[model samples]
Structure formats: structure tokens, C-alpha cells
Target: MSFAPFSDAPGTLDAAATAARLPWSALAEEIAALLWDSTVSVPARSVLPLAQGGSLFVMPATDRSVAMTKLITFTPGNAGTGRPSIQGDVVVFDIATGERRLVLDGPTVTARRTAAVSLLAARHLAPVPQGPLLIVGAGVQGRAHAEAFVVGLGVQEVWIASRSAASAEALAAHVHALGAQARVVADADAALPHCPLVATCTPAQAVVLSATPRSDAFIAAVGAFTPTMVELAPALCQHVALHGTIVVDTGDAGHEAGDLLQAGLDVATMPMLRNVVCGPWTHGTRAGKGPVLFKSCGWAGWDLAAARLAMRRAAAEPPMPAAAVRVPA
Candidate 1:
């Protein structure tokens, strides 16, 4: 049988390459646009247990132009092991041609896109968008959140707190390198009153942030994604539910938002990102309301948005030599 050469193969991107294409400002904008786009469809993600308490996740989303699937493994115990806790790849395909288009580094997409979601929430929820910030749990998400706030919100100062002093210091150094003042706080609760903006990005097996924030503070709780994990205390969640406004990233949060679910809150009735951004909902900041809590449970649509943005940025770059690409028969 004669073999015909396929001209195009999927382009691959490593961690740095993927991150380069997803700038904080641009990624946030893309996600915001997707929030209002009814054409995008995201199915429920499937999770299966792996050895040693790890989990394998399969998430898929599609739009008219492209389709994406993210396959990743999450190992919470990878901490201090020099191995990433979350590892995977996001595969993008052209819907019209049914051909692979891009393979993006999964960890980079998760960190950047997840942080961008928080940034979008802050834009609408934060009382004082520009200023000092507090990040609990100085890990990959913590670092991403710090950078996103610095670039997207023009935040000048950051306070980092973690159980591991070394990790907190390392994240602080990273934030310092980003031209923002960074401090490794000994106690997150003590630092809470000083910073109006807070992002909790821990593992969420236990409560990391329990203190009551300022009346106008904005808190993005993104650490825990499943029903079994939780980051905020039940009391804190209840307090926010009663006195403040709680916004969920998507409708899926009703089942996956561990903080709100564990707190015994009805997540289904909460305002979603679309409602806050596109609808006439002004309970959080306007009219001098209480604190705003943004609960993020993650949605595959966010990954598709990142893939779309990455593809657009890649189109602007110089193409690689055709010979460098390996096309299978």
C-alpha cells in the first residue's frame, strides 16, 4: 500500500512555552468572554483513584471551532518529593478537520488558567483591587496567584503563609522577583486583617484560613475541588453566606465545591461567574455589602479557553520547519 504524507502534525508546548502564550491579562479576558459564550459546552469531568491516594482526571470541553481534553494525575503526597503534584497534558483538536492541533503542558495550563479565573473573580468582587494581597499555602497555585494579581490587578505587596517556612520563603522570593514586595507571614490569620485581597490555594484536607476577613475583603477559595476536600472553616463559610456574597465559578460547583458543600451551604442557588459578570447582580461590592467569597471548583470550559488563547498566540509566532514535525501514516 502506498503511504501519503500528512502535512501538519500537532504542535507541542512545554511548561515554559505554554506559560508564555497564556499571559495573565489575556487569559483572564478569554475566560471572561467564554463565561458569556453559550456556544461552549463542558461535560462533567471523570475522576478515578490511583495508587497511593492519587487520582486520574479526564476533562473534556468543546466549542464550534475546537475541542479539548485534559488528562492529568493528581498526587497530593508529591509535596517535598521534587515531583509535581499535578501532571498532565491538554490536547486540542480542530473540530472541522478532526485533526490534532496542539498539545499544551497540563500543569502550566492548570496553574495559569486557574489563577486567571481567580483574577476575574477579583476584578468584580474585590473592594480594593489594587493593593496588598494575602496568599495562603505557598505552592504552585500560590505562586501563580501572586503573579496573576501582580500583572492583572497591579498589586504591589503580597503576604505568603504556609506550614513549610521554606516554601513560603521561596514563593516570597518569586513574588519579589516580579517587582512586588513579598513577605513571609508567620500567621495567615494575623495577616488577614491587613490585606483586603486573599487567595487560599492549599491542599484543603484541613482548614488553612479560618479568620474572619474585613467587611470589604475579597477571598478567592480555590484549593479544594472535590466534595471531600475543604480549605475554609465551616463557620467562616457560614459567616460569608449570611453576611456576604458567595460567587461560584460555574454551575458544577454545586457538586464539587468542597468548602461550600462541607459548610452546608446551598451552592446551587449561588450566583455564577456569568451572572456576576453579565447579569445585573450587585450584591457583593456595590451598595456597601459584606465580604465577597469566590468559590472555584474548576470547569473544563476554562481549559478550552486557555487552549483557544494559546492557539491564537501560537499563530502569531514563526512556524517551525515541516521536517521537524513527525507525521504518522
Candidate 2:
């Protein structure tokens, strides 16, 4: 049989387009429902090491659709020899027919969806905070978080902190250009007191950053995905012991994530995102600490959802033979 192929070039659907299409508040509600529904199931992800320094992730899930996505992350050190620091593709197929119908450049989708998930977490876990916002890490995810928060949540001020001062300054400039009050802070700790809402977007191995929220502060950490990568200290997990909910992308994966692992915590006890959104149990006095701690280990369901959304949007456009044609047997 002959299969058809369609490609979405990088920036084809710029950050704004992606942000507009996937509204964080709406998507967060949908994610909450999906999590509570028993029909939806996301299998454990499979990781494959690339010949270079990066690794590829094969994520598969079953719900209304049986979908699989392949994601690869290459570091600068590996890309120097002509490899991309982050590159890959996603192929979405029709469940019954097993027809590969949608092809997407994975990196763009990854960044957008990752930010979308972070926004969802912030919306559900953090209390409404006024004033400037603090974003740790000035990479793609950091920028996307700033854009999504301002557009999705009405955030006014944005302060960025990065290992690279230049990167932080550049991100701050971009945010200001977007009409939001923003600046780069040399000290993340100092920025924390002023901003009630803090998001850590770095991939640091240890607790490179910390925050002292004023009684009602909300923190969302999405940087670390593996056991070796950590952005928040273990003590932060103790915050959950005091008050608020700790929402993890998945219980099993959290145990493998550095923030949770280093904290010497058990993921099974950590509340999943759905629990916090649905209020499975009264959060109790801990709830008084603030809203909650939201941590994402990254999930395949997110990729599947994004792929589905992108495909639906593409179909609404003028039909292209390559996009609509079926494979020939």
C-alpha cells in the first residue's frame, strides 16, 4: 500500500496561532474530564536513545483515538555536527483504518503543548495573583508560558530569569514588545517575593531556583522530566504536607521525575491534575496554604490531544489531495 504524507513546517502555525487555537482554560477543563474518564488510557512511554546526544520518545494512547507520537530532543552539543538540538515528527493515524493521516513537525507542537499544559496547571492550582509574573528559564517553554499566561490568564507583568543573562534580557524584550510590562531579573529569589505566580521552566539538575510565596502564592514547575533533571527542591514537596494539592501529570512518572524523586516523595500519594480540578477530597488546612503545586512529567495524551486539534483545524482549510487522499492498496 502507498501512504500519503503532509508536513507542517516550523513556525507555519506561529506561537500566537497555536495559543489561540488551544485555549488553556478550555483545554485544562477537557484534560480534567479526560483524566477522570476511565475509557481513556495512556500507556507507559518508550524512550529510545539516538546515535547522537538526544533521545526519542514514543508515546501511545487509546481513547476516542488510538494515537502515537515520536518526540526527540537534541542538545546543542550534539547538534554541532549537523544535528538539530530538538527535532522530530508526529504521525497521527485513523484508529480503525490505521491510515496515517496527519504529519506534524513535533518540536513546535511540543513547545506549544508543553506551555499549554503549564498554563492549565497554573489556572487550576494557583490563586489569582496581581502584579508582575516571574518565569524561571528563558527558553522556548519560558517564552511560550509568558505569552500563554498573558493571553490566557490576563497576567500583566512578567519577569524572566535565565542562566544566560542575554537570553533572559531577550525574552523580557519580547514580552514587553507584546505590550506586557516585563524585565529580566538577575536574582530569582528577589523576583519571587514581588510575583505571586512563579513558573520554573529550566531543565536544571538541582534546585537552582527557589521561591517564598506570600501566603497565597501559586507555583507551577514543568522543567524537569527525568530523575536526573530537577528545578525545585525536595522541601517544596513538603509544602504539600502543609497545604494545597500537588498535581502530577501521572503518578508513576512523577516518581521518576527529579523534583519528586529528590524530594523523596511517593507519586502514588500525589494528587493527579484531575483530582485537584475536580476536588476529589477536601484539601483541608493544606488547602489554606494556597491553591496547589502542579508538576508535569509530560504525557503522551497531551501530544495526542494536540495532534487531534491540529488535524481538525487543517481539515477545515481548503482540502488538499495530499492531505485528504487515502492510501492505495
The numbered model that scores best in lDDT is 1
lDDT of 2 by residue, 220-268 (tens): 7887887877887776666654655667866766556688777777777
Model 1 whole-model lDDT (C-alpha atoms): 0.89
- Model 1 lowest lDDT segment of ten: 320-329
lDDT against the true structure, each candidate: 0.89, 0.68
TM of each candidate vs. truth: 0.93, 0.82
Per-residue alpha-carbon lDDT of candidate 1 for residues 204-322, written as tens digits (9 for 90 to 100): 88998889988888999999999999999998999988988899999989889999999999999999988888877754435467888999988899999999998788789776455
Task: Tell me the alpha-carbon RMSD of every candidate.
Answer: 2.9, 4.6
Query: Which pairs clash inside model 2?
Result: 74-85, 243-286, 244-286
Q: For candidate 2, report its TM-score.
A: 0.82
lDDT of 1 at 117: 97
